[model samples]
Target: MKKVLAGLGAALLLFVVGLAVYVASRQHLKFSVPLPAVAAATDPAVVERGRYVVRNLASCPICHGDPKQMERAQAGEEVPLSGGFEFNIPPGKFYPSNITPDPETGIGRFSDGEIARAALRRGA
Candidate 1:
């Protein structure tokens, strides 16, 4: 019984130490961005096509919240694309950002290439 208890205690200690190391290592992770390839479209047709892709094909509004606002967007009535969705998980509470063109709370500060990269690839 004594030997079994000692082994269990050692195993528990090892687990705790391993967990601590894993959490600490997460703080030092480096993010790398790739070079931009394509520029954002300026033509009205291209913009409309992108909007159609987002609303009808991609189902962005499903995750974005507000069916009525989504409907307005679907009708092409220039609705705000500000995202404020929250996803609760074991690691942390994940809040999706407001993606509107508003400079303060959205992706307005990001360049067109930056937006394209972020939309097309992970960790951009």
Candidate 2:
């Protein structure tokens, strides 16, 4: 009985080690889109168009808008894109990321290319 238990424990340990190695090996995934060296568009018209697309087209307000005035946002009232909305899904509550350009809590430091890649690949 002791030997059987010991053998089982060893098998479990080997399985766990193998699983860890597999996971670590898969960390470096090859993506279809390479990180582009694009810069942020600074033209006034382009900026306005981006804002319009986010406000009207993208579901940015629903997921990334301020939680305090979420109702107004859902009703199409323009609210600050603060992104504190808590989603109560199957796993539990999840507060989406702040989409503001506040530098610390938002996407201020990220380059335009990195932001676009994340948005395209991970739906950030």
Candidate 3:
């Protein structure tokens, strides 16, 4: 019984230490990016081009898109992006961020610089 208790205690200590080290390493890996002065373009042509890129090239519409509209988008028809797609993968379950103009649930709350950096993944 004494030997078993000692072994269990040692294992618990090792797990705690390992978890701390993993957390510390992740914190060190975080990098800060300077926000740029640019804002999302408002030109109609640029807007349409961005939509085209997201729908076709990057295929973001197939993932970070409205669930109800996914069928249309998948069928090669352009659908409005209202990001709320979800998936589970390593680390955790995740949902694509809302990109619509809604102030409460979308990019409307974020500054232009933040949006630009996030979109370009400046630090990531």
How far in Å is the alpha carbon of 104 misplaced in model 1?
2.5
Collision pairs in model 3: none
Instruction: Give the candidate order by descending lDDT.
Output: 2, 3, 1
For residue 45, model 3's alpha carbon misses the true position, in angstroms, by 2.7
Q: Where is model 2 more than 4 Å wrong at Cα?
A: 1-34, 74-77
Native-to-model Cα distance after best TM-score fit, residue 122 in candidate 2, in Å: 3.9
Instruction: Provide the clash count, candidate 1.
Output: 1
72: Cα error in model 1, Å: 5.5
TM-score of each model, in listed order: 0.70, 0.64, 0.66
Candidate 3 residue-wise lDDT at 110: 80
For candidate 1, give the lDDT of residue 52: 91
* Candidate that scores best on lDDT: 2
Worst 10 residues of 2 by lDDT: 115-124
Instruction: Provide C-alpha RMSD values for all models, in order.
Output: 3.3, 5.1, 4.8
